[model samples]
Target: MNINSWNFKKDILILQKELFDSIAPQTAENRTVANSLLLFLKYSAKCLFLKWLCQTVENLK
Candidate 1:
């Protein structure tokens, strides 16, 4: 089959739609990763503070 026989505009539109569809999931995934990273940072800071507090208490004993 000749490439010219295909509908070029329609093919381009389809490809564009597919590209957007594929990208949509990545956008959602990025949001999830960002949220997870924030949670991790918060938890890490809390843990560090607790550890430091415990060490200080032990030092006083």
Candidate 2:
């Protein structure tokens, strides 16, 4: 919830965007698999971030 942690989260989001942008799939099948993997990773990251944020909020109190 602090400025430092907010900046850190922003940096992480930038990194994640760069990472996802760097992935290039050539064939249709590869593209499908890549999309699926990307979706799964995004979902997982959201879940983890929410969990961490909840814990941080609890600790702050």
Candidate 3:
């Protein structure tokens, strides 16, 4: 990819890492909430990506 795309991806990775690092420290009550939301987001993203990939593959076929 071009420098611009690389820069954008780098920024997103940095942000994601920063967010995880910041959320790692959970007191007591916010622990479950934090983990649940994180997992939900992760799974939702995976499902959406897989759906998109399937569509792309079907189109190619």
Candidate with the larger lDDT of 2 and 3: 3
Which candidate's lDDT is highest?
1
What is the lDDT, from 0 to 100, of the residue 40 in candidate 2? Answer: 100
Of the candidates shown, which would achieve the greatest TM-score relative to the real structure?
Answer: 1
Q: What value does the lDDT take at residue 31 in candidate 1? A: 100
For model 1, residues 1-61, the per-residue Cα lDDT tens digits are 5666577867998999999999999999999999999999999999999999999999999
lDDT of 3: 0.91
Write down the lDDT of every candidate, Cα atoms only: 0.95, 0.90, 0.91
Give the per-residue lDDT of model 3 (tens digit) for 1-61: 8999999999999999998888776544498888899999999999999999999999999
Q: 23-57, model 2: which lDDT tens digit per residue?
A: 64335669899999999999999999999999999
- What's the TM-score of every candidate structure? 0.70, 0.51, 0.52
Q: Candidate 2: which pairs clash?
A: none
lDDT score of residue 43 within candidate 3: 100
Q: Give per-residue lDDT, candidate 2, residue 24.
A: 40
Instruction: Give candidates' CA RMSD values in order.
Output: 3.9, 23.5, 20.0
Q: Give per-candidate clash totals.
A: 0, 0, 0
Give candidate 2 regions above 4 Å deviation: 1-26
In model 3, the Cα lDDT at residue 8 comes to 98
